[model samples]
Target: MSNQQPPRRFTPMSQFATDYPVLLIDSDAPLRELHNCVSERLNAALKYLHLMACTSLPDYAENDINTVTNIARILVQDVSDVFRVIEPRGFETLKSQ
Candidate 1:
């Protein structure tokens, strides 16, 4: 007999959508505070990625490069929302030179 596993079926979120928006609305902190925390972590992750990207190129593979690029794109997209929180909420930003 061959050693292989059967394909697994994917389940849609609609299968568990009975509660809708109200189910997961609870959180320990306010939404704005959560947004700020997420932004800070994303910014730190981007900085870490920058450092890794600057390191020796010979140690990385084609897949590693692609993975890093994709993750950075996602982090940047989420981080942009931080600006929405900061600016409209009257937080200070550094002036560009």
Candidate 2:
């Protein structure tokens, strides 16, 4: 008598569509504009840092770093400007009152 083993059959589960929350942003809105502005500045800084780290060319890398640093300075100034607009100091305070 020969012993025969039965092959097991596998059944695959059906793929179900998953629902995900969608984030919608208005392109013409201030929130989207601010997001875009911040993204661009940060991307620029990251690219400059990447270039500086990857290349041994100090002349070019130094310039790139400097450019990023300048952009950072400008961003800082922008923050200060926004702060001023949001919370302007009184003239007396400015005059050391």
lDDT tens digits by residue: candidate 1, 11-79: 112113365522221233355775776668687777979888788878989898888777676566545
**What are the TM-scores, per candidate, against the unseen true structure?**
0.46, 0.35
Model 1: lDDT of residue 41: 62
Q: Give the residue spans of candidate 1 off by over 4 A.
A: 1-35, 91-97
Pick the lDDT winner: 1
Q: Give one digit per residue, the lDDT tens place, for model 2 in 27-53.
A: 223444544555665666577557657
The lDDT, on a scale of 0 to 1, for candidate 1 is 0.55
